[model samples]
Target: MKAFLPPTSYEYVTVHKVQGDDVREASDVLAAEEPLEIRVGYGPVGQREHRTISITMRTPGHDFELVAGFLLTEGIIRSRADLQGVLYCPDVQKEEERENVVRAELSPAAALDLPRLERHFYTSSSCGVCGKTSIEAVHAAGCPRLPPGGVRVPASVIHQLPERQRAAQELFEQTGGLHAAALFSPTGELRLLREDVGRHNALDKAIGAALFQDLLPLHEAVLLVSGRASFELVQKAAVAGIPVMAAVGAPSSLAVSAARNFGLTLCGFVRQQRFNIYCHEWRIS
Candidate 1:
């Protein structure tokens, strides 16, 4: 399916442009950025409890997918069955507030460790997890190391992804200010794409789309991002069971380290018909 392009993804604004003393007023399109509040309802059937979990800045669209992806990657919920329902907050009075807020109801059978989640947010907000601790936390969250040699992608297929990813980024082409995450087949066909102001949010949207379609543990797929690969992105990929990840930009030191530890094949600077494989090179033939 083609990527869903939300009308709210961009806004038109009047701007002044100056080029070497030549100045003119023109209309410009900018990628829209807004805060999204994610809430969750859990517990027994009638005695459910709700809590506001996160408020993140994102381009408004694909809100449900973003929430679903966040829950799974964070180890809050395991599979699609864990999500009972997802909807906008109906109790909010303001229409805009209602649009900004989303609540995901979890299945009663889905276990929630509130204390651990609380600690996670505290550490994430306070100073961020250290590199070593972050790797350990992935294991603690039950993300297994990827097995080797299940999927092999040709180098030519890898070379074609950046261009395809760019072509599929409709909002970025219009606004020149959004990050994109895409899933591709091993043979290089685009399966899904999502764009957002935040890189992580974009990836979450893509992964969430896969999750909603019951396509998790994306073992035979390749992931491509429009920006540099970070430790967090690598961790998300591993958690999603994606075996290969490629980035148009560079991969950070910790990202490479985590990919090696997780046995994920990571490729960076994936443009100009060339790329660097950080670890598990056997997956890229």
Candidate 2:
């Protein structure tokens, strides 16, 4: 199934390179990056509206999932019921128009927060809403402290995720320029894996897949990231109701605080059969 995804997600580039002490021409694979404009359509019956919510650079594949996950975590739409449909805005006048812009239509009863959407204009995939004054803002936007006793995972299962995640990162193996996020069952079965040039985009793609699959409130899964855990990563996991987050790299100070505040089990340096649990230790056994 992974092979069925779009191959346009990466491109081969010719480069001037050095081989040992000799200069040589080289061709390398690069993860494709392009700007995606996400728009929202919501209001009341017979009063439908549309507005551009954000523009961020991301890889070319899994775009619908990316937009869905972004809207879910941003508190724009609560669940699948709130989403009417996701479509690429059709503009016959341009060739790239359909590929570059995504529009999410909402159900009639779903209220659009205009101000919140306006604030989202400043967000980028690299640092999601990082300029906000406080973490409370995120909480106010609908992030909740994850309920405890959600799921318990064996230590051995947790140790195997990185390898499993790597097995799915075909683009990363070629370019080494992408980040990945994989979702695993409580028993450690790998469920979904997504990769993007941006770490946040990768996580969003993973969450979006779950959202589309009617797997929200991810209380029975662990999210494994290929890189450091950032505050946005924890926030996204909390919004999606994922109980545990494991990263192959270290976590930031804000990520640790957000995990503790939101009651998530976060583990870092997950390699060599040893991992450092930073919060919610009860979930690991």
Candidate 3:
């Protein structure tokens, strides 16, 4: 049987559509965005401790995958073995808020680094040299430099990715406001795809799905994002061991720097059958 999934889009809002003096009232579909509180349950059998980890604004579907990907990319839980289970918070009294919260139970053997986690959240919320500092911290967190020559893709394949990803975006076709992240085989076959109002959240859901399937260290995969590449997105891809990342839009300067530092192949403006390889060009054939 297919698993039950939550709704990812909403259509309750009515809007006025005016085009060339042709105005009419129409119902519109929107990519659902809601706050998800991620809680972690840790410690030994009889001395378990539960703590709220983060609350992020995200689309409603794939909540479990989002939590798993967030934990992995944040350097919280290392692997699937570190996770005991992920479930909705049943104690939430209001029915509507029940699915809005999720808990990831950690194995007793999994070490909890509260200080590092706290520092991560702080840096994320701050400005200034946080970009440079965050990149350095990723190094400090033991995100390995991607090994050289393990994966390669053709420029022809890269050229076709954006269109393929867009075609698979069911929610985006309806709302036209969702960002997407997808994992593809080196040969350009789409493996997993996720959509969200937040770019990073979409990536987390995709990576989280891979994690649940024990597909981490995605050394042979190509990651494609529907929007511009950012530092956070690059960092998350590097942490997940994705070798090559391509974006339909431009990449920030810091994103290029991080990709170079992490030895990841970064591609930007991947449309019109052409793209710019910001770093690690050898990965593209």
Query: Which residues of candidate 1, in runs, are more than 4 Å off?
Result: 122-128
TM-score of each: 0.96, 0.92, 0.95
As for lDDT, the candidate ahead, 1 or 2, is: 1
> What order do candidates take by TM-score, descending?
1, 3, 2
Residue pairs whose backbone atoms clash in candidate 1: none
Runs in model 3 deviating more than 4 A are: 1-5, 120-125
Clashing residue pairs in candidate 2 are none
Better of 1 and 3 by TM-score: 1
Instruction: Give lDDT tens digits, candidate 3, residues 211-255.
Output: 999998899999999999998899899999999999999999889
For candidate 1, write residues 120-218 as lDDT tens digits.
542242346777888888888878999866999999999999889988888988999999999999999999999999999999999999998889899
Query: What is candidate 1's TM-score against the reference?
Result: 0.96
* TM-score of decoy 3: 0.95
Instruction: Name the lDDT value of residue 66 in candidate 3.
Output: 95
Task: Report the backbone clash tally of model 3.
Answer: 0
lDDT of each: 0.90, 0.86, 0.89
Error of 1 at 64 (Å): 0.2
